[model samples]
Target: MQIFSFKKFLKEQFILLSLSAIVGILSALFIAFFLKLLEAATAYRNSHFQLLFLLPIAGWVIYLSYQYLGKNSSKGNNLIIKEAKGNQESVPAVMLPLVLFGTVITHLFGGSAGREGTAVQIGGTVAAKISEWCKLNQQLRSILLICGIGAGFSAVFGTPLTGFVFSLEVLVIGKMEYKAAPYSLIASLIANYFCLQLGIHHTKYFITSSIPMNGEWISIALKVGIASIGFGLAGYLFSYFIELFKKIYSKILPKAWMIPIFGGIIIIILGQWLVGKDYLGLGVDPNYPGAASIVGAFHAGGSFTWSWFWKLLFTTITLSAGFKGGEVTPLFFIGAALGNTLATLFNIPIDLLAGVGFIAVFAAATNTPLACTMMGIELFGAANLPFFAIGCFVAYYCSGHSGIYTSQNIGIAKNSFLQIRNNKLLSQHLSQKELFYHKKWTLVKNKYL
Candidate 1:
């Protein structure tokens, strides 16, 4: 019986790993297909097709979809976050095709939406289908779903570690799934390998200069404080816009589908008018490879063109209207733009600052500062390791009381507040490491008491 049971366990583990690998390969193929589709659709939609005729038809389809699928259709990555928190809300298997179709439709009709989120969901939903077949328990289900999410993100970003951390950390906001870490890492690495083997190259960037840190602890202090505050505020603003858009939609629209269709129309109108049609989708040419730095607001020099605000406004409106896509890549572009906007003030090079903001703001907005900083190191290289670390910490704290994942519980102190003591790492019960008004004594004081 013991020998048979051991063999059975081995068989199960082997099956699970094989399934994971297979899912990873499928995810990679999908990522490639979707990227090509994105390029073709954008070219056709912008250059070949007329916006006036295209948007109305897209709106009609969305209206029908919402009517049939209903407003309760999962809200993409945000929905995944909730599921990570033990909601046991099984994502519909159709999520893969639905998101793929919607994202294609969103971009094809000239809406300014990104594709990473949809891509990740597609991979995740594909991976998650195993749970239904195997009848997984909740804990196992969460792990499987996370592995799927990692595969999708890894396939898309081509940054395997970033994808793994993103999957493990994104679960409950502040909380990390220690157990999911191993599986997520394995799946991401496997997926990244498969994707790379198929010639899915990573998005690359060029760097010009170093951040020029003096290696002093105090120097890092100010930099961290300033940058983190900016990132945190940016995150707060992002959430604010989402709220504002929802309010507007609730007031004016009949249902959810009309929101994005109209948003697509608005983007098309604005693209034609103020900024031209270049700045649309996950990112424009500005966020592409060799376009590392951004333009100054004041300087009219034509070295680089970065439409910081327009992209933000466009993506915000696009997502608010229920257009499906990844928010991270757009957030990356926005952070880079914000960093570039402050080039003159800090006297830092545009490239350095842009790199810092690229990761920091996204980290703050999503409450995944550590993961974001790690992404900076992984994608941007670790030349400014200290800077990314400082920036991520600062942005994370400064982000105030907002998070992209609504289901995330507030575990750490939101702001300055009294803990059982000033103890960040608390014991089971309150120890002598308590804080009163403004004082720090020790065991002696507690003993005296």
Candidate 2:
């Protein structure tokens, strides 16, 4: 019986490893194509400034495509998270193309968004389809889904370690899914390797300043800690405003499709007249030199003092208005730009703080401190891992219970005093909290009036 059990376990492990490789290859290929298309779209939009006017039409077309052909695919990354968490719903294959098409259109017409969400969705869709084809059991299916996420993220960003950790950390707040770690790591490594082999290069960020040692460590830590609070608040506000704008748009627009049209108009006004074009598209590279970008945030005076706020506003409006794409890159922009601004006030090196903020804000918003910390090391080297940890962990806690993904659950409460029930969705928790406050307010009004 022992021998037979060992044989079975070995067979399963072999099969899973093979599947991970397959998923990695497929994810890398899809992401490469997606990136190419996205790059072309952004370049064209930069040259033809008039393309911004057709944003409404582009949004309308995206709405029609999803409404007609996508079915429940509009749930986007949430659907993948739900499925990974044991929901009966399956991630549809059509999601890959729909999101890819929508994201490309969004960038082509100047919608301020990022690409990570789209990549993750594509990876999840691919994994789901492969699982269906293989007729895998629920347990195996869940593991593959996670591997897919890791593969997609790793391929897109060229950070295998971050992708592996992010896959486990992102599914649940305050909990890491260790069961999937080995498979996720394998998928991430394979995907990153294939992506680089295919000639896709990720952006590079460096910390040029000297690392402080001895007596300066204390002051550096203090300053990083202070800036982390701001990073956390920024992340909280970003999540809060996205949810708020969604509600406001839904209330104001009678038709479901009209929301994006209105959002497009607002973006046009904000991008063209008010905020300028710095905050549009992926923001990895702007149209002109010295413009605000993830790359520019490394140097002193690379970004305006208000650059972070403007990017935050543009992204919140773009995403809330129903544009396609992910939020991670925009979060990087916000974090880095904000870090650049704060560096002066705190008397820290510009590159160091900017690098820390790049990951810290993303950590806060996603509630994945470990992954973001790893990302900092991957992007900027391990010389400043302590600062990275300080900023990421601080921002994670300071951001409160809010996060970019509504489907994420609270596996454990952040604090013992909160008394939050475990395994509840963040959206449900937010709704219940609102109800509790409303009841309190109503009671107060009745007694007073």
Candidate 3:
């Protein structure tokens, strides 16, 4: 944990600043190009409904590509997290193109997915490759990777502050890596600027009004806290079900390729029958009038009551089936839709609740409460800062130890009494606890019943 002297600190900061600038530029370029490719692919899918039936074929191609070229790269976001936590030595250079291709195909073939995972992979791959070529030390390599994550996140979402905090905060729950703070921020800002310069547009959210931070704000914060409990549980459910579905699919299908084929058929049948196409392919586009979307969720009557459930179902099926794409964007869609539904029930402002769900669910699922709070400010503005913090913190605690990234470390337990060992991966901690409880339950059942 030793750092540097004042003089050495200044010198290192200067070097990292310059390095982050370069990383930022590279990340923005990659994100811009990838986003354009995604847009084109999505447009094609929207125009050709028949392509939905081709999803099974697309899954086979994606599987074969990974089997041939991916190697350990199939680890996906978990690999990047493991590398950042020093659990893995390196990320394959091929992961960059492999993930990009996989994600594009997922979208092109009507899989419900998101873009953040692919962008983060692109960033981490680029940073790792550069660090290897330059022969940088481990500390420097780690810093560069953090910068790369921040740059990629900011470039894609256009939320520089969120990206900055997310990079350092996401590695270990309840712990932040301040050592990489300067580089993360620098990379995020520069990358966002570069993405905008490249004409890659980001979505903008608008809230009509927010309650003033006066004595009455206490009541508002309490309401937000209550709402965030549901948001947090929604996030937790999303993670739990995705993992559970993976287990179920593996048990039934046994083979990886067959899983996607069955999953594709289910998605198509369910999509065409139950929810139609609204829940597939991002869930952010209003393909028809009054279609559910993050934008529409801000207004009353804009989202159906079960919109969140449908999105969640599609996302879980898509990801568990081995389709590419991230969970964050679809999480956004789910959160926004659920928030809209809750607002009607609670009689709170529709926009405010929607905004809270937008970040709170992500905070819980990612275990990056601080970053998600900043995302609220960056995306929705600071008018509801107190509410945002309350919502995020409540959701974070309610989310338990589960998260989207299985490789994330438990640097600090959410509750002091929980007593999870420091630096253990979340998956390890959860599995150990499950085994312990199962043994205790079996003994009790044999002794009593």
Candidate 4:
């Protein structure tokens, strides 16, 4: 009876998990469809519409989002991160629809946001609802919620393994919950299936050429190290800008809503007069031959143009103005471009720099070096793993304490210090200390005597 009962228990839990995973996948598919619609609409507006019309649309969406969802609504992503790390409560179901609509409207009106957040929120909210219905325990609920995140990312990005790792790694404050893996994997696979069925896919950057066997290893290594400086610097700068913008708006600008309004007008004027509209949206443009040529330029030893800088600024302001989506992919775009541009100075291989920039900035921004390293393998093929490992890890360390998500804990210092917080440093833990300090000084003559 005892043996049979154990098997029965496993069977029951597996079935429940399978059901929950299915819900996670379906939620992601639904979210992906909506995100695609928003993308298409944004594409049209950027190309065909006028900047004058965008100001009013941004105002109206901000007004609706404010009235219906409240200012607290935009906190969904932060709340999700907090909840995943043992907070028990999951994101509200209402958060799903609200963010979906708000982001869509934001992009439609050229608000300079992205779509990954919308999809992830939709999946997570759906999973949270399922957990509530089943009356699952806190651990189980967290697992379901993560499954939702993996599924959403997998469907939208077409990268199931990386999405699965991202789900776990994003929550890597410490001690991972081992039980979450099965659910996350199931959800990712299910979501990928649905994406395949619907013919839904998002932008994916890759290195198509093979790395030469027993060739240019030293050059590749040097390029990775050099480009990493740019990645680390850019990553830190991105976080800095967000905080500065927030302070400018909250402590410096006129008011909350008006700040975004002011920001929108500035974007409209600057986008048309100075930079043009290419930098105004999700940062994807398959239609532009420049996009392809630019991608190739990384392999050909080229630098980013002035337009890329404008796009980066526009994106920053868009998010600072209360629009939704994540800065992860945007970091990728900027890093790749910047890496290519800087590589020209070093005269190193362009493909190597592009690959390094792509992952290192992501590692720095999210503080997920391991995930981004694996991402390098998955996206660029395993051939680039050695250079990726060095560049990504170094940049991750060089990134300092700044990160886009304020809730992230300082588990360990970027580098070890002999004495932390005035106590003999047995091990490094997050503390309010400068990035570097002189090693502890002890005179051996008298020590404890």
Ranking by TM-score: 2, 3, 4, 1
lDDT of 2 at 430: 84
At residue 270, give the lDDT of candidate 3: 78
Model 1: residues with Cα > 4 Å off, grouped in runs: 1-16, 69-72, 211-221, 255-257, 284-306, 416-449
- Tens digit of lDDT per residue, candidate 3, span 203-311? 8898877687676677767888899999999999999889888888989986788988888888899777867888778766764666788888888887889998889
| lDDT tens per residue, model 4, 317-397 | 878777766676567667777777766777755666777787888788777787688878877788778878887888877
TM-score of each: 0.82, 0.97, 0.95, 0.85
Report the lDDT tens digits of candidate 1 across residue range 1-449. Answer: 44568886687677667777766777878777777777677666655546534764675576577457734345677666556556667677767766777777777776666677876787777766776787767776777778888888888878889888988776644667777777778788888888788776666754456545455545544654586577678876776676678679878988666676677677767776766554565554433333322332112231233555666677788777777666777677777777766654566666666777778888887777777878878877888777787877788778765655555555555465634222122222112222432254555567787
Off by over 4 Å in 4: 1-12, 51-53, 56-60, 88-90, 173-177, 209-215, 286-303, 306-308, 418-449
- Give the lDDT of residue 324 in candidate 4: 67
For model 2, how does the per-residue alpha-carbon lDDT over 240-259 read when each residue is reduced to its tens digit? 99998999998888999998
lDDT against the true structure, per candidate, is: 0.67, 0.91, 0.88, 0.68
Lowest lDDT block of 10, candidate 2: 1-10
> Is 1 or 4 the stronger prediction by TM-score?
4
Q: In lDDT terms, which candidate is top?
A: 2
Candidate 3 lands at a TM-score of 0.95
lDDT value for model 2: 0.91
Candidate number with the higher TM-score (2 or 3)? 2
